[model samples]
Target chain A: MSHPEQAPEGRRRPASPTRALAEPPTTRTPETTRWRICREVIIHRIDDEAVAYDPGAHEVLYLDADAFEVFKQVDGTRDDAAIFLELAQQHGETTDEVASRFAPVLAAMRRHGWIGRTHGADEVS
Target chain B: MSTASTIGGRDVGPALDGYNPARRASCPAAPGPESPTYYRIGAVTVCLHSADARFREPFHHLYQRHYIGGPTLSAVHIRVDRVIRARPLGRGFRICVDGEERFLLRKPQAVLPHVEWAINAAVAATLPRYHQLHAGVVARDGFALVLPAQPQCGKSTLTARLISRGWSYLSDEFALIDPDTLRLDPYPKALCIKEGSFEIVDAFCPTAGALPSYEKSWKGRVRLIDPQALRPHRTPWGVPVGMIAFPRYVARPAPALHPLSRARALFQLLDVCFTFGRYRAATLDVLGGVVERAACFQLESGEIDATCDVLEAAWRAHVPASGRPDPADLTRPEEPVRPGVEAA
Candidate 1:
């Protein structure tokens, strides 16, 4: 997986307002490894939004367009760096800019047990 | 077997009209040992056996045309009677089903409200076949419009207005939908007009004066308007839902109709359905089909006429000409008559 520093030239621009607002704090450990969507999470996309129903938790979540795209990419194989790279390519932004925008959202999803870290063994919190 | 009469080309059994409480108590309807008054509300047959004379008048008035008499099975059996000797200070009466007390009436005047409450509870308890939603339902041109809202949202007022203006009244309190087909069944009970909405309903329905209002009840000053009086013809029992609307009565200049996305509509429906948890997957699937086939909207209005206009326009636009079913096609066989004995 490519790191944020290896983002291609010409795609880098000033961070958008959402990226600035969603910027992760430096004290938190960077989530470099790949994250997989929880197997129990069932997602149904309607129009621009997606509704995720977790049978285990009996919880229903509403994911907006950007977050829904991020969730849809969590297939257990891709690392966070790779997911951000693809999102950057799709939205015409640098990998660093996409990472900044999705960093907080991804961390929150990990905390909520919506996604898990895959490092030889699955770890979901 | 009791004598039957054909009303509007449909066979109906003798109503509890001429039988005073004393006469009813002396000779309950036969074929059974005890006399239980049988009344049909749409598809549900309720057998009410109450010895209290106080429950007779209001029960007759509220459920006038719904009485049926034959030898069919009853879906629910409800009994209401005085708890003890009618002392001035004693608790008034108790409503029970299978000897289990559901509610107690504190005064003679509170009998009607308690009976209505008890009947609703009985239906909720006894009948889990159809999925019930906390919504108001009305239909026009072979398609039903479902108004799902929380209490005090002016749902009954709007429903009464629309029904008075020629839209067929299905129900005001609960919208019963078939879990398999998503077709809405009509539960045309008396429209419970609250105190705040009396003026609006009276203006729209001039014949509403004949209906009496019960004061100091559970829902404040409440009046029950018999939908039959407004539209004397036999209305349809079921209709394919064509539209799902969430109405909000706001202090606005004009009525506004905002389109709702399918996801939002589904979420709103799940929130309002009474049996969502019991039939989760089925309810979700049925709701998806309903949302797909129907146009969903959020209506905000203070003016009743304007709101009706908006709904009618939606009906014309969305419900196709070929898709409209005749009212007669939607009517079911006259509610089955059951042998019930009238108790004192």
Candidate 2:
């Protein structure tokens, strides 16, 4: 079983100073990037929280209502901007406000290896 | 057709009669020692062979009432013998099941207590064939009432009181529910009564004075109550669950029974399960079916009588008017109920 915090082998590594500076600013924006859920996770919704069971790690993770909504929207099809827009429409808030509020949550999910870029969905190594 | 005598309308072999611990202790070692006692509790069978005289009498007195004299096959084989070489602490004994050592006690007097613990461990290990939960169970009118609670929550006291008041004893430790048929089987072993509960239980059971009790042990003063003595000639069998109650002992004036949603009940049941994590999805499906069919409650009480009254009423109200199906009919397999996702 793989540790939840450890990234898989052969994945992308941190960019060096020159490569970081060469990267385009638009590519870092949430508008053009889409996310997909990990293939080894099984989620069951309970009340306001969703329980995610990872078979690979034999661990159960909890996601509150807001985080669960974020998880539901990461279906490998929608960009972060589109998910934020949909959630903002439901909560009667602007897309910018929703994005600002959910930025930390999305970062935490990425760090936990629960979500990844949709373009690398098949590259699980 | 067996060489056992009938007691309380049940067959109990002459194992207790032929028991001569002193002679057996002095006799030379044999190539293989055969057990003289056999007992059947619900679906589990126990065969005990002891070379130590100190453990024989208490073992006989504790389980004589629960003896199964007929042709019952033994599933668990236990042998207790004293250590030949003396240590600095002196004589000691070790308990083994099927030739594998399971427990060792420094003092000979601790043999009885260790035997109880060993038997419970053996039973727990054998019950993984069914979905097992840490709960106290009692039944009446074919409707089983499951009381799942944490330790020191007054589950055993309540169970003893209910059984003394005509409720059939199912089990005081584990509720083994068949995963395929969704029926609860009775695992009626001896009920372990703690110190503070002696007076309460003694008042209810007339034969409590004759039962053997160990003092100054780990759980304070403890006594084992043979359920068969309370309800003689009764066969412990499976029954459909009618209610699931989470009991809490509180110092209050009156007892209260609060309704619990199926989701909350499922969560509570899962929290008290013994081996659910090994079979995650299947266990959830089976437990979802259990909570759906059984009404759930949270009971808080200080008085035993009042608490039992509330439970009886709840059982009466929740059970179907057509009554539960016959135990013989419940052996057939049934489809698992779909999991219900209720809002938390």
Candidate 3:
């Protein structure tokens, strides 16, 4: 269990362009995580343009856009604390709040066999 | 009974989903006589709960909730337990049957045609490495034939005819391939015996089994000929694809076989595909692998007997003539998957 540095800008919320143009966020209820058989391996859009894959055991697990963004923030070069602060600044959320949200998403992804846990220099650094 | 439910973020009741008021002005529940019994396919699986029936032949009713009347002969009901948006074309419709998401479709509406298509799509999409073909696959004595034909080209009729003559019907519409082993996965189901072909079937097998024909489709009338009626001899797990035949039924007294270049056959198969543009890269990769290994032939048959003869001869030429060899002997290793390749 580790903590990230506080954002220098303190806890300013990010202004999401998606939030302004979109409908108000429905209650962010937790979706029951399920492993849908990968029909097509799409690393793209959420709509019909998504790709399908028939998963083999050797397949790399993938994340949806929301999940992948959380994953992209993880760099082996940075410690959890540094990574948290950078992502919080990028998304304009408090470091603590961003880490709290990131934890559950990572847990969900790991549970679904998307990504395996890795210990690297970035986390130690 | 278009019960209310939510689909694609819209409060789509049965009526809205079926009639699509924008697509059709009048919303008629279109009452038709219900069949006395509902036939269940796929060997009775747990997904029965999600199955929706579509009348394909001898009946006009598809399902109680979803009904689109076209001249149909056989009906298939599929309960789609999961509709995930996974394909690049946005049509990754998978149905849970046989304990696997065996079917995959690129256009959502394509699965709506018949339950068999939905199930077939799921099976085809999930197979390892090999191309999922847009053709009917039938086999006999461990030898399999992939028939890729354009609509009105008598592919189904040929399938029914061959199945009647001891060929095991893999599927009347789809052919699934597994790249890992180069085996043709069996998706045995009903054959879409066209109206004109019905007479040919009657003449050939005289005792041929067929469902009733619906007189409402653009193709005059169509019916389904059950594969089981032919008493298929083998339930072989999978077969190596041996030949690719593009067949057309023209009302000529004579039949002709045309040797098509692999390129020509590939384009022809792609052209007849319902969702090639949607599946794009995956579909291209799959088909490309298949065409490379199998010999391609075009059959112009004016008569049923002549068509069968041409097929038999072609089979003799491409398939091992010694008979009943292990499927593993004929298969070739699959080509490596290229990176970031989007099929045009």
DockQ of each: 0.06, 0.06, 0.01
Tens-place lDDT digits, model 2, residues B131-233: 8888999887777889998677888889988887788888888888888888888777778888788887887787775555564247776777777666563
What is the C-alpha lDDT profile of model 1 across A32-83, one tens digit per residue?
6678876586565566555565554444454546667788788777887889
Ten residues in sequence with the least summed lDDT for candidate 1 chain B: B335-344
| DockQ-based CAPRI category assigned to the predicted complex of candidate 2 | incorrect
Better of 2 and 3 by lDDT: 2
Off by over 4 Å in 1: A1-30, A33-39, A42-50, A55-57, A62-67, A77-81, A91-120, B1-34, B85-89, B215-218, B324-344
Alpha carbon lDDT of each predicted model: 0.66, 0.66, 0.49
TM-score winner between candidates 1 and 2: 1
The per-prediction tally of clashing pairs is 6, 1, 45
**Per-residue lDDT over B135-156 for candidate 1, one digit per residue giving the tens place of the 0 to 100 score:** 8998887888899987889888
Q: Is the docking of candidate 1 incorrect, acceptable, medium or high quality?
A: incorrect
Task: Arrange candidates, best lDDT first.
Answer: 1, 2, 3
Error of 1 at B237 (Å): 2.9
lDDT of 3 by residue, B33-130 (tens): 23223333322111232322222211212222223334233333344533556446463445544454545544333343334544555544443334
lDDT of 1 at B321: 54
* Native contact fraction, candidates in order: 0.02, 0.01, 0.00
